[model samples]
Target: MEQRPGKREERKVTESGHRRTAVAESGSPATGARIAGLGAYRPQTVVSNEQAAADAGVAPEWIAQRVGIHERRRATGSETVVGMAVEAAREALDAAGKDANDVDVVILATCSLPTAMPNGAARVAAGLGCRAAAGFDLNAACAGFNHALAVADGLVRSAVARNVLVVGAERMTDWVSAHDRDTGPIFADGAAAALVVPAIRPGIFPVAWGGDGERADLIRIRADTGRMEMAGREVFAWAVTALTPVIRAACERAGFEPGELKGFVPHQANLRIVKALGAAVGAAGSVTATDVTHTGNTCGASVPLALHALRQRGELTAGDPVLLLGFGAGLSYAAQVVLSP
Candidate 1:
């Protein structure tokens, strides 16, 4: 039989006054870490293919065939990154039956923050009333959510935090130029959040993360010009050839068979990339998320947003096994197996 998560275990306090136990160390704690709930915030304005195509100087059919995006959300006034994150976090906390005071840490993942001085997570914490929480930001581009999930899992396992709110929020439209065909129509805006807390059994599996700094130039934000640029074909090829192994390695670490997973949630990059990666990993018959079709590529927000969308669409159930793959700019990527909440 497969090793199940949420096996009940008694907690023990160490001399350092930290909680520790077999379940917490290896396998369960009222205080073992698991994903408790998920939530998302899609901007109100919907920009259709026609509008985007006009801006990119491409036909609506061309946009559909190329990226498979039909419409994407565009944030307008008052829909700032931190604001969206807080909204999603609130819904997650409500779904988890947790109070803002319960959260010990807040991690916001994104690369589109308008300014760098005041970390967005701090504002998110304050907005959500997590008065005593530690807050910070992470920018792994499209891989941000997966990276934040790994960090939250570890923090909960180590008893450094009882509840951690992991959020992926992005305003990619803010970074792209309207006339730039390469990125203008391909990126959008959105936010999603997950509530992670101690549990009796393990819910989050170990993460397989790696990056290629040498190829970082494949996608980058020009500091001097402050515009986003990309070689779409090169990035697509790299993703097709490179990310399959990361998926397999994550399954190996979690002891999962290809067909065992109930769902496959990858970063919502594009329909082509989503289909290719899913096929490469043999994700047939699974409810693979193609959120990019409607949400576009929300960068850091993609994976978690896709996850929340899947749950809303009833394509997943509680305690279902899911594989999450995140790959993006920085030539960075991460993959992991998780139990759907």
Candidate 2:
């Protein structure tokens, strides 16, 4: 699992009398960066609509019509955030024909880590045997994967690193309350990862990201109770109306028309939001990812998980343009277009 011959060592810095490892950075711009590989991991335990409805005190049909989830994965005690991230990262590295040590940076996008002391990325890097890699965490809620992808793109373009591993992993069930129907059946657990490396041509486009901190309370994890809460209808309305501009901006940045995209992979919050966003963008010719039908709302892991599923189904192929939009908690949102790997 060592890097190939002749790779540079990762950077370390001494600042303010404290020492720390850092992702290598150079002022010179690179040729570009592309997603070289992708992978995903879902939990073993599956919860059906009937099971979820019974727990939520609702009808199975009501659950189906409301969120469009038939079933979703629930992590067993044996499965964990770091472990799932490692599994997905390993598969992504294998798909990219790379070894763990080849990575110089690791970025994990998540919001549901049980404790906040040591970040999950460092542990994941350690698990993968990337002893020299600089690791960090990012929290943009459902928009996390896309935000991390954008950061990876900029890092590569600015010569911050030659190889970056970006992973989105969440254990959302921990934040959700079983008695709260709004979130009980909606949130699930999973992880997905992508490998970004320098490329001769642009495989990733510029990202368009923004947030409305004014509406932060729309989806919040109560500090006192540590339970997740949401204003479902308001959030849904905001997403359907406010996000299309973000989508259009990303397409404009990529020099692509919506009709030219091969696929659309938005966060799998629910099916209604997914379809509304798709229709708003008029991506009639693109294959829209509906992984929420099976995977439920995985929050941070939603985008990459859906992207991996699309690739597996042969709905997207190398060099095909795909639009990715992620919006959720934080009242945050980000969008980008990338060439499918």
Candidate 3:
């Protein structure tokens, strides 16, 4: 007898030395998965370049010229990472036309949680009323959102979950010193989310991801001071020189060229890096996100938040192909092309 396309049978020897035929179960009916909705939450408190400059011992003009940031949002005491994630998740659920009951899993992507005791995803799931949804956290630093997005795509397509809520939230202010010129003005606080669901056609494409553990020391939080440290010049050099191939690989995986992209949403790290990467990829015709100008680098939340900004501005339409790239701390990077929801 012939087997079904997705089913397989294998003969294996058991521990007792008995040969048994094992059947591999088929996955969900989904051919692929796509992001059904996207939502973002920017903290209410806005920090201007003047304020950041005062703390970093630099002039406002210097910041603008160096990083291309005029202002950024800073989360207050009430805006915990879990709380912001919940807010963003609720908005994403609403946008997806789904309720808490529809979610089977919740993945929170973040790196700024104060402690590792109780994970943030559980609280996020509880806050969103997803009582039965399994929850966990994924930490890839700034590349976290893109990483979680790829995982969500797999979960949905493989029948592991019918719907996955992927949230990227951060309170970078908690980890970076306000007085550190390297990290202070660049990092900010925000949250964004995406609802992944089964689709007849793939909306989320393959991811080009990698890490450089050898360069982990380029960006890290010091244990002694409990503050974040960064080798800005080194990081910038690595990003521009190394990530162009990643961008191209992602586009090729999606069956498109960089020039064919309608939008380019890289992590909102800085204006210079964003532009250099964009140019190297030859995506000049794309509507590249410059969200860093206002949002700063919200770490994991940067990519999704930038995507939301483009949607809000009506720069992206349904079915438009956009390349999303995220790279940062941990020396991690991931890129993929996703159709605008």
Q: Highest TM-score: give the candidate number.
A: 2
Candidate 1 per-residue lDDT over residues 67-139, each given as its tens digit: 9999999999799999999999999999998888677789999999999979999999999976567899999
Indicate the worst ten consecutive residues by lDDT in candidate 1: 22-31
Model 2: residues with Cα > 4 Å off, grouped in runs? 1-28
Q: Candidate 1 clash total?
A: 5
Any idea what lDDT model 3 has? 0.90
- Candidates in order, TM-scores: namely 0.91, 0.93, 0.92
Winner on lDDT between 1 and 3 is 3
Between candidates 2 and 3, name the one with more favorable TM-score. 2
Residues 1-341, candidate 3: write the lDDT tens digits.
21222444243546663334322245335677888899889999999999999999999999999999999999999999999999999999999888986777899999999889699998998999875677899999999999999999988777666679999999999999888888899999999999987777899999999999899999999999999999999999999998989999999999998788999999989999999988888976799999999999999999999999999899999889999999999899999999999
Q: How far is candidate 3 from the true structure (C-alpha RMSD, Å)?
A: 6.8
181-255: candidate 2 lDDT, tens digit per residue: 999989999999999987767889999999999999999999999999999999999999999889999999999
